[model samples]
Target: MTDQPLPGAYWRLWFAAAISNLGDGVFVIALSLLATRITDSPLSIGLIATFATIPWMLFALPVGVIIDRVDRRKVLVIADLSRGVLVGGLAVVAAFWDVQIWMLWLLAFGLGVGEVFFDNGAQTILPAIVPRDQLERANGYFSAAEVTTNTFLGMPLGGALIAFAVWLPFGVDAASFVVAALLAASLRGSFRPTNSVPSTGMIDDMRGGLRWLLGHRLLRTLALVVTVMNLAFATTQATFVLFAQQELHISDNAFGPLLAVIGAGSLLGGIIGGKVVGLFGRRASMLTAALTPVFTSTAIALWPVTWFVIAMITVQAFATTVGSILSVSLRQQIVPGQLFGRVNSIYRWFSTGAMPLGALLGGVLATAFGLRAPYFAAAALLLIASLLVATGLTNAALSAALTQYSPVTTEPTFATDVDTEDHDTDDTPVSIDRDPLDDLLAGP
Candidate 1:
């Protein structure tokens, strides 16, 4: 592996992800607006958002096994093609036909199903395309691209475009998917099957992925932290709508600009994650890691006006940016290459599975208690997770746990089930792309 991404493959992934996430961002904001226009109930929108996790939760594990056993490139192409059709077909229904709330629910269900394959394939396939040491850079680039779409371009563009024609955003969203599918079609490389574990049956594959995750203490801890954060954050999207409507006194469709502002924050945060790892040192990164969400959450709890709310949302995006880079890079650095797909699948499943409950709890709290209450709960949970991680692992230990390539690493393994980057029993950054612990695995 080299320090930079394989130029061609990386660009291919970049274009595909950018176009797809852009469409997704646009569709999500538009969907929220559509639901509100069709019915006055915020709760319905909230419920719909809650169930958004169903695809990831239900299909993730199976998708992981599939990613492991099949050619990753093929998986991506097929998933993108399916999604393009679905989005385009839905656009017609939303644009021309009458759309019921239940229909929207059904659309969500189908979209969720495809997401399982797409999301799993994307993350698991990334390491194969880039050099090992570039994990931070790769994660940063990916997050930055997504932020550009959802925040800088997609969310605002989608909402603004919708004012022209209700179907415009949906149509645009559909178009993005088609473009993504085409881009995916060009990526080379068939994740060639190795005789390592020998492809097994479905139930065995599931058990293998699960068993791998449970076997490692660091990964176990990391999974728990990620799951908790996701559960707490689940209430965020629903509560944000309430806050915009009631507290800020804004219309449902007008928050697109604000969301875009957050995208800027996310962009900055993501760019800094790579620099932060080098400057602050990974050990010190943990305590500082807690600040962005804390800042974002506390400010939102204060109930600012539209401008202030925009700033707070920006902070949340920034926090998400940094958090994503740190966690993802850490996992990529540590996880065993062979089982990386399986372990990541479990992680996705838990996060997505928790989303529905989080959404429901948020909606309930807003209607029964108050709109701002969910923010308080979300902030508290983030704070707690931060504290637990700090108290449990020393900074040096934590850094090593995250970046070390040895068997001491707790993340899931890669497909090759081997680490051959630096064969010596040394424990330092071996090269620009190779970590000291990489040679421990019996991989290709």
Candidate 2:
């Protein structure tokens, strides 16, 4: 299985992901630039980021349940189409009228909603499509595609497009989403969970996942570590545009290119992430990932030189991408297929949910101290997270967890046993002789 080529359907999914992420890259730069036009207040600009990420905190649990119940391909299609409509509508509005800060916030929030479903669904569906031995390689491809399109190509293109007109980037973003949607819809076969049992209700399902994650030491620690890491990173992200303009003395035209430079490291990391993990092993890889940001954040805060900042951020992106690939692959390998959506949502609910608060904190810090304040704060927080990772994610612990929870068979249940016609596409329960989580939890 490891030597075999990835199936054609996987490529279709990959293409759809690449195209949509390209639009996302464009959308991120364009949105920030537009917000800057409306206001100079760092707090207001930060609020836009806050709105965009708040949905992961608010809606992740329910959306997780929804992903497990429906055809995941349909979820991906609907999410893309909805985001396209929202972005297209925003483009039309921006062209005709004076765009307000609140409007950008609203648009960001809507897009965030679509992302909650789409991201989780994509993660849930992958193990079903490719062989288990190839999960790391497959994820590396995804991470590479996302980095290449979203940041490398999309970011620079966005900077150039915004120079033409405000509405242009948004329009391009809308079109990308629509095309991605069509490709997602073309994927064949049923993607419903095979081990889905009679419903104990949504709340119960959510609790089940939460309990399993909380009970597992390795995963639980990783989730918490990611939460702190994201919090620290988000603080820098919320204020980075302002920092570039003020401290680094970068021009608006150069902003996208600077980001693209940072992305180059991530692209490299994504391309070689699996190999790095295999070479160094997960514990060492994860520790490096945790520690790199601490020095990088401090360097940017102290120096703020353009070349120095780029160098530090590029290194930071590389380490972060490697850690992310390892973490996601580990989760996919360990968690039961039926519980993947709910557990993943819970995991992200903690990890990504902290971004809004981080954004708000960045805004406040910048307003009170200075633009550089957020970077200093991020450095402090990330240092603590690094310490946690150093102590908690030991090589022995990671190996034990993998040995305990790895699936008994490589074949996914959805490949054969799932009856597409009779699949319960709603909250209604179906009978199973034993709970999948029983086996998962029973492992020591």
Question: What's the TM-score of each model vs. the native?
Answer: 0.85, 0.91
- Candidate 2 wrong stretches, greater than 4 Å: 1-5, 408-412, 415-444
Tell me the tens digit of each residue's lDDT in model 2 across 172-234.
Answer: 989988887777666556767666677779998899889989999999999988889888888
lDDT of 1 by residue, 310-365 (tens): 78766666655666677776766776666767778887677567777777777787
Candidate 2, residue 36: CA error in Å? 0.8
Off by over 4 Å in 1: 1-8, 399-444
lDDT of all predictions? 0.64, 0.78
Strongest candidate by lDDT: 2
Q: What CA RMSD would candidate 2 show? A: 7.2
Q: What does candidate 1 score on TM?
A: 0.85
Ten-residue stretch with the least lDDT total in model 1: 435-444
Candidate 2 overall lDDT versus native? 0.78
